[model samples]
Target: MRILLAAALLLTSAPVLAQQSPAKTMTASQDAFLRDYAETRRFMSGRPVNPRITPDEKTVLFLRGQPRAPIQTLFAFDVATGEAKEVLTPEAILKGSEETLTSEEKARRERMRVSARGFTSYQLSEDGERILVPLSGKLYLVERVSGKSTELKTGPGVIDPRFSADGQQVAYVRDNDVFRLEVASNKEHRVTTGGTPAKTHGLAEFVAQEEMSRFSGWWWSPDAKFIAYTESDTGQVEKLSIIDVMHPEKGAEDYSYPRPGKNNAKVRLGITPVTGGKTVWVQWDAEKYPYLATVMWPKKGPLTVLVQNRTQTEEKLLAVDTASGKTKELLTEKDDAWLELEQTFPVWLEDGSGFLWYTERNGGPEVELRNADGSLARSLVKPEAGFRNLARYIEKDRTLYFVGGPNPTESYLWRVKDGGAPEQVRPGTTGEAVEGGSVARSGNLAVISHSSPTSMPRTYVVRGDGSRVGELPSVAVEPGFVPVVEYREVGPLKFHSSLVRPRNAKPGQKLPTIVEVYAGPTVTVVHKSMAAHLLSQWMADQGFLIARFDGRGTPMRGAKWQRAVHLDFSGVTLEDQAAAVQALAAVVPEVDLQRVGIEGWSFGGYMGALAALKRPDVFKAAVAGAPVVDWLDYDTHYTERYLGLPQQHPEAYEKSSLLTYARDTSKPISPLLLIHGTADDNVYFFHTLKLSDALFRAGKYHELLPLSGLTHMVPDPLVTQRQHEWVMNHFKRHLAK
Candidate 1:
C-alpha cells in the first residue's frame, strides 16, 4: 500500500532522471551530492523491465531507458545470436507530433505509476508472431521481423488492447465501450454501446484499479468466442474536485472519489460474442459480493472471477459458464483481517482439471492445487517460508516456479513438481526469476535479474536445470558507494530492521539517529535487496545513523502479525517503532536515544506526526510527508478494510487519528515539518491542512512546505530533492545536539 506520493525515484532501480534530456534545474552541488550520496546513474542504467522470453526461447524482449533519455525503447536480447537490437522507440511511435493522451488514459497510467514513454508494456500474441502495444490512447501492432509498428486505425481512447487466443482478433476499450478488431482485414466491431457518462464498459472501476489490482474490466475467453467484461456505474460515487492552484488557468479536475462508508462503483459482469451480439449477464448476489478483485479465463476451462464483500474480509472464487453466464463457487476464503490480493494467481493447470490457489487455510499462506469442483488435490508449498508470489507455471514441465524466503528481508525462488512440496530453485542470494530479482521464462529458458545488499544487481539467462546459458548485457553503471547495512530483528516483538551507520563512525561513538519508517500494513520498510535502502544509505552518509523497521502491522510474516493492528493503527505501528529503537539501542550500544528523529511518508507520516505530538520523549524531531491525519478522509476499500465501517467502529476511528492527540502538549511538541503536494488525490492535501489547523490551535509552531502541482507520488525530481533537503535541515536543527 504505497501511496502514490512515493512514486518519485522509488528505489535505485526506478530512477527518475532522464539521461537524454536531464533537467537543467539541478545545481552543480546537488548533482555532486546525487553522485556521491547514492549515484542516480545506477538507476538509469541496467533497468531492463518486462523481460519476456520468446516462445522459441531464442530471444527475450524488454523495455530499457535511462535518465535524460527516459522515453523507453523496446529491445530484444538474442539467446543464441547474442545480439541486442532496438525494436522500436517512442520517437518512432510518435513520429513527429507530441503525445496527446485522454483523461481516461492518463488516469490508468497514473494508477500503474507508468514513468517512461514508448512501450511501457506489451502483450505477445499466443502464437508468438506479433506484439500488441497501446500507447497515447491508440493501438499499434509490432512486427517481429523489422520491429516496425503498424498503427491500428481504431477509434480514439483505445486502451488495454490485447490479442485473442489464436491472434486473429484484438480486443480493446474505446471511450467506455469494448471493441474488437480483426488483424488481417482491419475490420472492427463494437462489442457494447451502452456506456454513458455515469456507466462504463471494458474499463475497470476506481477501487478495482486502485485497490483490488484488477486494471481492466474485460477478460477474453479461451476460444476467443466470447468476451467477459465489467460494466461500472459511477453515478452513485461522490465527486471530489482536485484543482491545480499552481496554474489557475488549467482549472479543477472533478473526480468520482469513494470515501469510506460511501458508495463504490456498481459493477456487473457480462459476456458478448467476438462478432458483436446480445450480452448475457452473469448473475450473482451483487449486494453481498460487490468488490470484483480479478478475472482469470483459462485457456480451455471456465472463466474464474474473484469477488469480495465491501468489508473485504471474505472472498469468493467462482467458475463461470460462458454460454449461460452461470457461475458456481469454486472456493471461499475468509479472514478476520482483509484477504490479501496477489498480482498473479488462480493458476489453472494446462490440462484444466484443477487450478492452483494461494491461501492461508492451514496455518500460513501456501499454494494449494484444487479440482474444478473445489476439492483440494495437494498442497504445493511448505508453510515455513510462506508463499509469496507465483513466478512461472511451466505447463509443459508440470512445474510451478515461485518465490518466498524464510525471512521478510530476503526473497528466493522455488519450484514444486506435480503438487509436491516446493524447494528453493537458486538459493544463497536475493533476486529471482521474479520481481526485485526479476525473472522471465519461455520454453524452459529464463532470464533472471538479481542482486544483494553488498552486491550490484545483474542479469542472467539460465536453463530449466538452473544452469546458466550466459549473462544478459546490462547497461547499468555500478554506484560509487557500497552500503554498510546490518539486517536484524529487534525487540521482543521481533520487528525486522535495517541499520546503516556513518562510514567513519567508531564502534562506541554515539550519533544522532533518524528512524525512517513506513510501518504500515500494506508494505514493508526493510527488505533484503540492496535497492531497498538506497535512501537510508544516502541519509547515513549525511553523518546521522539511520535505522528502519517493519513492525507488527506490515505483511509477509503471517496473518497474525499483520492482523495485530487490524483496527488500531496508532498503537501497534508507533509502539513497535519505539520498541525497536529501545531494543536496538540496547544491542548496538551507540544509539543516541536523546536525539532521535522520525521521518516517513503517508502512513509513516501519520506515525511521525503522532510520535512528536504524543510521544515526543522518544521522537525529538519529525518529518511527516502527505500524512493521513484522519482515516475518514481516505478511500473506501483501503480504509474500511482495516478500520471497518467508521460509523460502527467510532472508537477505532477516534483512536487512530492524529487529530485525536493534536492538542496533547505532553512534551512541548517537538520540531515538526509537514510536507505535501496540493494536488495529491490519493491522500489529499486537506489532511495536512487539518493537522496544521489542529497544531495552530494548540499553539504548536511547525513548518509547512506546500508543493503546488504535484500528486502523492512526486514524479518531479527537483521537488523530491528539495523535500529531501528540507527533512535533512529540519533534523539538523533539532536532533544535532
Candidate 2:
C-alpha cells in the first residue's frame, strides 16, 4: 500500500529559487553552503526526471531544467549514440512570456505536491510518435520526429489530458466535465455534462488526490472505444474555508473536507463511449465498499476496479462487463489493521493467463502469481526477499523485476524468470553500484537511478544484463563537503539509526545533539545513501551532532513493525523515538542526553510536539512543522486507517493528540516552537491555531511562527534558508549549554 505523509521539507522536493521574491534581510544569515542548498533545491535541480523510454527503446525522452531553477523543458536522449539534445522549451512556445494558470490547474498541482513549472508532467503516446504536454490550462502536442509543438486549441481550463491507447484520440477534463478530441481532425466531443460544484465528473475527489495519490479520475479502455470516469458528489460533505489572513480582502476559499466519521463524497463510476452516448453506470455494493481506490483496464483482461470499506480494513477487486455494467467479484482482502493499496499490481500476462499481485496476506509482503480467476498460482517472491515493489516485467524472456533488499537501509534490483527464485541484478561492470537503485525498463533497456554512502544520486542506462550503456548526466552543483556519518542498528528493536558528526570532532567530546526525525508510515529516514544525510551533515557542521532514526511504524519493516502504530499514533511513535535516542546515548558516548532537541515535519511534526509536551525530560526543545495537532481534524482516509472513527475511538484520538498533552499542566513542558504555512491546505493552518489556543487556555508557554502566503511546502529558497537559520538558532539557544 502507498501511504503518503509529509516528511521533513528540507529532505523532499523544494521549489525553484527563481519563483520567490524574498526580502533583503532573508539572505543575510545564509552561508555559502546554506544558500547553495536552498538555491539548488537540495541539489535536485538540473537532474533528469520523468523519463519515458520509447516503445522501440531507440531513444529516451525526459524533462530537465536549469540549475537552481524549476522550469522543466523536454529533451531526447539517443539510446544507440548516447547523445542528448533539447526538444522543446517553454520559452519557445510562450515567446518569452510568463506562464499563467487557472485556479483548477493550481489546485491540481497543490494536491499532487508538484512545485515545478513549465511541463511539470507529460505523457508519451503508446506509439511513441506523439507527446502530450499540459501547461497553463491548455494542451500541447509535440511530434517526436519533427520537434514541433502544436496547441490543441482545446480552449482553456484543460486538466488531466491523456492520449487514448491507440493514440488516435485525446481525453481531458475541463471545468469538471470530460472532453474528447480527435487527434487527426481536431474535432471536439463532449462525453459527460451537468457538472457543477456540488457534483463533478471526470475529476478525482480531494481525498483521492491528496491522500490516495490517484490524480486522474478518467481512464481510456484499451481499444479507445470507451472512457471510464468517476462522478463525485460533495454536496453532503462539510465545507471548510481557508482564508489568506494576510489579505482578508481577497476572501476565503471553501473546500469539501471530510473529517473523521463525517460524510465523504459520494462517488460512482460510469462508462461512456468516445463517440458520445448515454453513460452506463457500473454497479457495486457502495454501502459496503465506499472508497473507489483504483481502476485498471488492461489489454488482456476484463475491466477491474478496487474498492475499500470506509474503515479500510476490507477491500474487494471487481471485474466489470462494459456492455451491461455488471460486476463480478474477483478477489477480497481483509486485514485486522488496514490494508495498504499497492501502487502497482495485477500485471496481466500477454495471453491473459494470470496476473502478478503483491500482498501482505501471508503475514509479510510477498509477490503471488494469481490465476486469471484470482486464485493463487504460486508465490513468486517470499518474505525473506524483502519484496518492496514490482519494478517491471520483461515479456521477451518472461523475467519479472522488483526492487528490494534484506536491509531497510538499502534497496537492490531483483529479477526472477518464470516464478523462479529471485536473484540480485548486480552491476556487470566492475566498481559500479546498483544498491539503493530504482528501475525503469523499456524492452531490453533499463535506467537505474541509484546512490551509495559515498555519492549523491545519479542515473545510468544499462542493457538487460546490467552492462552500463551511458549516463543520464546531472548538472547539480556538488555540496562542497562530504558528510561524516556513522550507521548502526540501535536498541533491541534494531532500529535503523545514523549519526552525522562534525568533520573535526575529536574523541570523548560530547556535543549538543539535534534529532531530525520522520518516524511515521510510508517513509524511512535513514538510508544507505549519503545524499540522505546531506542536510544533517550541514547542520552538524555548525558545531553540533545530528541523529536520525527509523523506528517502528516506519515502512520497509514487516507488517508487525508497521502496524504497531495502529491505534496509537502518538504514544508508539514518540515512544520508539525517545527510546532510540536514549539507547543511542548509552552506546555513543559523544551524545549528551541533557542537550538534545527534536524537529520534524508532518507526522514527524506530530512526533516532535508529542516529545516536547510529554517527554520534556529527554528533549530540551522541539520544532513541529505542519503537524496534525489532533487526529480528529485530519482527513478521513489516513486517520481512520490507523485510529478508526473518532466517535468510536475517542480515547485513541485523545491519547494521540498533542492538545491532550498540551492540556495537561502538571508536568514541565519543553521549549516548543510550531511552524506552519498560512496557506497550507493539506495540514491546514488551523492545526497550529488549535494547539496554540489549547496551550494559551492551559497557561503553557510556546512559540509559533506563521509563514505568510505559503502552503504546506515552503518552496522558496530564501524562505527555506531563513527557516533553517531560525531552527538552528532555536536549538543553539536551548540545547547549547
Candidate 3:
C-alpha cells in the first residue's frame, strides 16, 4: 500500500508510435538537472529540516547535509547571534571509517522512508545542555557548551536511544530489549529480558510504524523514574521471506507480516522503573482495542495511550495509573469509517487545568479543550476556522499555535490566545504571498518556516510580538527556475487541481498530457509550495503537460470526501482521475483529450494499472511502480481499515483488485510498464509478479521491470535517474500527439 504519499503515461492496444518525439541523446543541461535532482533528494538537501528550539530558547538545532549529498550533520544556530555551527558529523565520530547499518536499522529506515546517512535523527536532553546522536548503531553525547562529543560505552546496534527527563541517563533498544545507561558512569541495566527475534520489547510493531507513523514504542516518565515500553509478540504472524535478488547467496530475511485477515502482533504496554525492577503491565481490553496507536507521557499528567479496534472505526484514550497498573477511560472517538489519528494532541496543561484535543466531530477537524476527566471544556477551533494540527501550546501565556489555511493546499500559522478567536500569524509580513508556513515555537520564541510558489522554504526567527529576530541559514541549491504552475478547482465537486506546461509552449498548442496522481488517503498532492512542482516542471519540460489533483478519498476535505474510496478503491480512485482530467481539459483547451496518459507509484500505481484496464478511453499509457495488485495482499491496518476483513467483504477486494480485471477477457489491456523492487517488504514484489502472471495467462501485453535488491524506496541516485529516464521514454513513445 502507498504511504499516502508521493507520484505518467499513454494508452494503446499494441505498441504503435504516432507523432512520437525523436529519440535523442541527453543535453548537457538536462543531464546535469537529472543528476542534481536525484543526488540532492529532489532539492531537499542542505535545508534546515526538523528544526527544534532548545529549552533555553538560545539555540535552534537542525540537521543539514551538503547541497548535493544525502548525509546530514547536526547543526546549531545561535539565536542571539544568528551564527551556525556544526555540532556533530558521522565522519568526525567514525574517524574516516565507512558507516554500516545493521539489518534492523535498514528495516527501520525503510519503514521511515529515510535515505539520509549520518545523523538521521537525534535526541535532545530536556535541560538543553546535551544532545544524543546515534550514528551507525553507536551513541554519542555532545555537549552544548563545548563542541566535544563522548561516545557512550553502550554496545553497537542501538535502535531507538532517548534521553531521560533529567538528562542524567539514557535509554535505548538493543537486541530487541530495552536497556538503560547512566551517562556519567556508563552503568548499564537491562530493563526487560527474554527478548527474541519473534518476541521483542521496546519496539513498535510493523503496522504501528508503517501505517500509524508511531515510530517509537517506549517513553520515559517526566520525573525520569520509569520507562513505559511495549512488548510485541509476533509468533502468530505469517513469516514472509524477502530475498535480495542481487545477492541471493546471503539468503532470505524472514519477517513477520500480517495480511488483510491475518493475525497481527500481540503488543502490550508495560512500565518499569529505571533501576530495572518488575514491569507493571497496563490494564486494558486488548482483545477489542488491539492496535496501540499513540503513547503520551506528558510532564504534568498521567501517562496516556490511544488504542484502536481491529476495524479502526473505534478508539479510546486511556490514562494509565502507574501505581496500580490500571487505566481510566478518558475519551472515545468513533467514525463510520476509520478514525484518523492526530499526531499532536491530548497535550496536558502544566497547571493541570485541561488538555487540548483534535477531533473531526464538526464535519472537519477542529481543536477542543477537554477537562482533566476528558469531558469537553470548550471548542477552541471550530470547523470554519480551518484548523490543522496543534503546533505548540505556551502554558505561561496560555497561547496555542496551530497550522491551517483557507484551502487544503495552503497551510498558514494560526494562533489562539486567552480564549480569543483564531487569528492568522503574519510574522514580519511584507504582503508577499506565503503559500504555506509551519511554526516551531518555544515559549515566546518561534521559528516560522514559510514558502511560496516562487521560492524554496525560508525560515525566520520571530519574537513573541511577531517581530523578526534572525533567519536560519539554508544551503539548499536553487533549481534555478520557478515552476510555472496554475492552481485550479475543476469538476462539479471542485477537485483541487494543478497544471504545469512547458515554459516555452505556444499559446494555442494542445500538448499531450500526463495525469500524475496518488489518489490515496491520508495525503494531498496538490500543494501551494514551489518545491512540490519541481519534478512536475522537469517532466513538463520534456514536451508534455502535467495535470495533477487531489480527488475524492484524499484528506483535509473532511471524512466523507476521504471515505469515498472506503470499499471501492479501484472504482473511485480511477474514476476521480479520469473525471478530473476531463474536467480540467474542458476549461484548459491546451490539455489534449485524445492524447492523455497516466502514471503513479504505490496506490497511484494501482490506479494507473486500473485505468489502463478500465478507462482506456482516458489514459493511453501507464507506468505502475510498486503497485498493490490486490487488497488482500496488503497489511492488516491499512487495507482492512478501508476494505474491511477479507472474509467479510471479499467482493470489495475482488472489485478493487487488478487480478480480477486481468482474468476477465472482455477488453484488451492498455499499454503498461510495471515496475517493482524485488526486495520491497512493504508491498512485496510478488504483487507485481502475480499480476504479471495473471495478465500473461489472459493474453495481455505489458512490460515488467524488476529492481534487484531495492526496497520499497529506490534511494540510489544513479538508479533514480535511470528510472525517470525510462519513464520519460515510455511516455514519449505512447503519449505522442
Best by TM-score: 3
Residue 716, candidate 1: Cα error in Å is 1.3
What is the lDDT for 254 in model 2? 89
- List model 2 lDDT by residue over 238-304, tens digit each: 9988887666788988888999989999999999988888999999999999999988889888888
TM-score of each: 0.93, 0.94, 0.95
Best by lDDT: 3
> Model 2, stretches more than 4 Å misplaced?
1-30, 428-443
**For every candidate structure, what is the RMSD over all alpha carbons to the true structure, in angstroms?**
5.5, 5.3, 3.5
Residue range with the least summed lDDT across 10 consecutive positions in model 1: 6-15
Which has the better TM-score: candidate 1, or candidate 2? 2
Residue-pair clashes per prediction, in order, are 18, 2, 6
Q: What's the CA error at residue 116 for candidate 3, in Å? A: 0.3
Question: lDDT tens string, model 1, 14-52?
Answer: 233332212233346444555533334335444777788
Query: After superposition, which runs of candidate 3 have C-alpha atoms over 4 Å from their true positions?
Result: 1-26, 427-442
